[model samples]
Target: MQAPSMWRHTLTFFPQFLAALKERAESDSTVTVIGASDGRLVVPLVAAGYRVIAIERDPIALHGGEVQLPGDRTGHAMGLIDRLKREGFYDRVQVVEDDFLETGPATTRCDAVWTSCSWHYSANHHQPLSEFVNRMQRLVRPGGLFGAEFMMPITQRHHMLEHYTSPERLRQYFIGDWDVLLTLRTNEFSEQAHVGQLQDHTHRMGLLLAARASTPS
Candidate 1:
């Protein structure tokens, strides 16, 4: 699919995705976006009336940083969140410039944590994925939501490919701990693009959704 089509597909997923979060989370809930490359999801999320803390490892990923949005085709800006300000959603947004893996578990918990393809970085950096899940699991308050579109290949090896975790391994990491919401395996259909030099193949992936189990009250 082309970029427009891919974006449209993603947009189709967002309504139900946001609806799930809205159903389970409070209107004022704070959401932490892992690898918030741009305001793509952040904008709508803010428009939905939730506070968002956008985290990005690479500072230059935001369109506001001298890179215009996809459709604009004109690069002009200083930071990604500039558009957020222009749209009056900046007050509801926060940017955290830190590596998700290196930053350690957050002391300040959030009502939900979200990520796109970026969640796999920690698994790539750290051995296995237990540490990464533990870190994210700690950040969300119990009963809070944790959602990400995961890259789950049929086979993965250290420094071998971009596929970070297998579906079964991810289950081992989250099942006992979280109440699974959605877990469906699919391929990388966005423009039929290939990723990485060694892997070079778009393998199977999963749209992961789970809610941290609430403590016994």
Candidate 2:
């Protein structure tokens, strides 16, 4: 598939996926944010009256008002937020262009948190995940929602990229702390092969949705 074609597929499917997640949340006044939101796919959630915050590291992609290859991307988080506002989704969102690790602690206090396809890129996944969970616990006020989609590693003959956690690893990462509500795996193929091949294969991708563990009084 062409680059544009692949992007089209992403744009089409991402919104629907987010909608399904929203249905599962089932909350009228959930304050939500997207961590490392590349294409601003969750803008619809804002339009639906949810408070949204977006954080991204790439300035070009964040501010360009158009999605491009991560390498070719430019702009800041506020730029994207401004673009979204111009597009009529500003009422519910704020965008910050900075390292997510730095922002996790301060901004983690929201009713819901959604990290889509970006957790794998964290410099310190463990610390950030823990902090994120803790922040959700504090911000969500119990019975709120947290959702994430991550790339998973799979041992297969033909795969796409690298740097994904295996199923077992992911399980171990969240088991003791979070009560898992859903675990799903799927396969994705890239239109352009060999563009970047740092991994063995790409057969396994994971989605996890769970609420923060209620604090013990």
Candidate 3:
């Protein structure tokens, strides 16, 4: 619910989180990034030497396109991609402007899949989560890893909490299929004020670094 303004601050600590996660990933790994809104997370992955396929639905956020920063939601996605390209990381990433749900998995295979703060956009949370998990399974080889950061109870509305999942529910959804690693709950405050006060909200996130189950021998 916190607007794009809040994202700036949240992203500041992202590098630390990524650094920790990076230790678990192999160098030059192939990672498919879904729902990569503005490439906030994808750029870091690229800089870390991971090959990425970034998927997004916003037209202005296509790979290699120019984007306005801070709050121009339209171009932010593309902007990040362009920045990465300028920095020589584009060689490690492929930018695609398409609905991830519509994009089939036959063209690009990956070693892992990473997503951040975008799943709440799904029309049906359960269905999308299932499809997303299945897609990750397809994109990564058997026993490969899947990682994501999701907003729990997604919303900034004072009276209304939107379609979000708690850490437990998220685990319930994937428990049998993947091994859970970490789940965290945290709070973020935004400059946007509601009724003359800055909007502060809590988000429960499931940071799952799980590996796909091995095929039966």
Candidate 4:
């Protein structure tokens, strides 16, 4: 499935996460996406035959709305719900419109959980970074995968907070009952403008992929 135009060229470790999912999960395995903005990753998971539990709080992203483009252009974004319907993957997804931290765990355990550049947002800074990571980890069942790609510290404000973290720092959270499969970090790199940020920006990012240990036989 094609991602929305605005999200098409973004940098994400989702491909790596997908590879882990394929190796570890069944075709019908349920994957939960925290901060599932506009189904960028959700649609593809559903298209690949996985059931998706999409948790997103933004109404504009989940339901569609006008957006400001890079060239002072105005565009109407096709929200996640509509995109799923258009692609005929709605039935494979359960969209939850709520603040992920405010909600409890899924009624059933998920085969995997993922979030991309989510915790760095100012809106999420009120909570400790550990809280966000811990919450996401809780949703994954034993033997399930947990993946996250996040912003690394680049500014004074970022340095002051634990939210803008590094791969090494994040690994501390996965020390027990989890296997740190892969960890990668990038130097500051330029990124093209997208819906929210209208100008080119530079960022340093990190990715972490871990698998929960299975229950003892």
Candidate 5:
């Protein structure tokens, strides 16, 4: 199948997470994507035959609207809803237009849940990092997969907040019934600006993939 145009690309670890999901989850599994901006990851999962619960808060990200681009440019965003429809994967996704932390747990437990560089945003800093993570963890049922690639501290402000975390720091949450499968971190890298950020920026990122033990440990 042809790939849908996405507003943003996914994290480096996404393919690994997808492979892990395929290996660990049923083909018809339900996958929840937190901060599902314009179907970057959602489209791939649905195209691969997994049902998606896409939770995002920004209206412009959900419905088509004008947006700011790199190098101080302006452009139009086709948005997640339109992208899903264009890809013929609309029926396979459930769009939740709300803040993930505020929305709390999804009504149903998902077979897998993923988030990419979402929690470090200043808008999300009001909540504790533990709250954001705990809620995401609770959304996955036993034997489910949990994947997250997040921004590690780069700027001074980022270092001030626990949300800008490292794989080592994040691993503390995966103990007990959750088995951490992988942990990777990137050296500081430069990315051209887009959307929320307008100038070229450098960032360090971390990835964590864990699976919930099927039975109590």
Candidate 6:
């Protein structure tokens, strides 16, 4: 597929993901947008009236352990929250400046959990696949939804193998513990982009949606 069509198909996954989420969440339900970069899903969830947890490594990435100066920043002071306030959803969202995987399961379970193209950071850092998958199972209450988009490697260069995850490997993480609801994959595209250019290669991205089963007596 050409890059443009691939991009269009790639963008469509979010709404499909959200629609699936709607079937599982109420307007007032609590939603957790893990790795909330630039408030993409966070703002929308808050605007739609679900309280959201906008978690990230920090409100903004720092330089050499120091905060970036105002002029050097590409985003706002409070990251997602700052954007939320401007959009009038400030009071509905909370920001957590910590690693999502390291933060582990939330103390308070939410109605739904979401992430867009962010889980690989934790994987590359050596977080076990089951830990994140099981953590999602724990963070979303029974009957709640968990959704995420991740780029899975069909093949990788020898040096790049350490940081890639395969689709098969990901499925093994959820096999028996949960009920899979939706599984979708997009055409492979050069996984890298630079200044409006795509390299001559590609990788497959898969979407996984599942529900936490109710506890049996």
Per-model TM-score, in order, reads 0.75, 0.65, 0.71, 0.95, 0.94, 0.75
Model 1 is weakest, by summed lDDT over 10 consecutive residues, at 2-11
Off by over 4 Å in 4: 1-5
Give the poorly placed runs of model 1, Cα more than 4 Å off: 1-13, 63-79, 121-128, 154-163, 187-203
- CA lDDT scores, all candidates in order: 0.66, 0.53, 0.60, 0.90, 0.87, 0.64
lDDT of 3 at 134: 67
Instruction: Note the residue pairs that clash in candidate 3.
Output: 1-156, 38-77, 61-78
lDDT of 1 by residue, 1-217 (tens): 1121112224124555687899999898999888776566777888888999998776655543444334435443434466576678887888887777788658799999887776566444654467666777788888999877766654436336534655555666676658878776665543322112122244455666788878834
The better candidate by lDDT, 4 or 6, is: 4
Candidate 2 displacement at residue 68 in angstroms: 6.9
Q: What is the lDDT of residue 34 in candidate 4?
A: 93
Decoy 5 TM-score against native: 0.94
The residue pairs found clashing in candidate 2 are: 59-74, 59-75, 60-74, 60-75, 61-74, 159-201, 159-202, 162-199
CA lDDT of 135 in candidate 1? 74
Pick the lDDT winner: 4
Off by over 4 Å in 3: 1-6, 11-21, 63-78, 122-127, 154-163, 187-204, 214-217
lDDT of 6 by residue, 1-217 (tens): 1111112223425676678877777889998877776565676677677898877774342111223322334322334555565688778878777877777446798988887766555343567556666666678887788888776666545226433454455666665546778888877665433211233346677787877676632
Candidate 2 achieves a global lDDT of: 0.53
Better of 2 and 5 by lDDT: 5
* Superposition error at 83 for model 5 (Å): 0.4
Model 6, position 30, has a per-residue lDDT of 90
Segments of candidate 6 deviating more than 4 angstroms: 1-12, 61-78, 122-124, 158-163, 166-168, 175-177, 190-201
What TM-score does candidate 4 get on C-alpha atoms? 0.95
Candidate no. 2 TM-score: 0.65
lDDT of 3 by residue, 1-217 (tens): 2123213455233443465457666778777877765666777787777788887776544534444443333332335466565667767777877776677655656777777766665443545466665665577666667777666654555114333655666666565557666666656433432211234434445455566666633
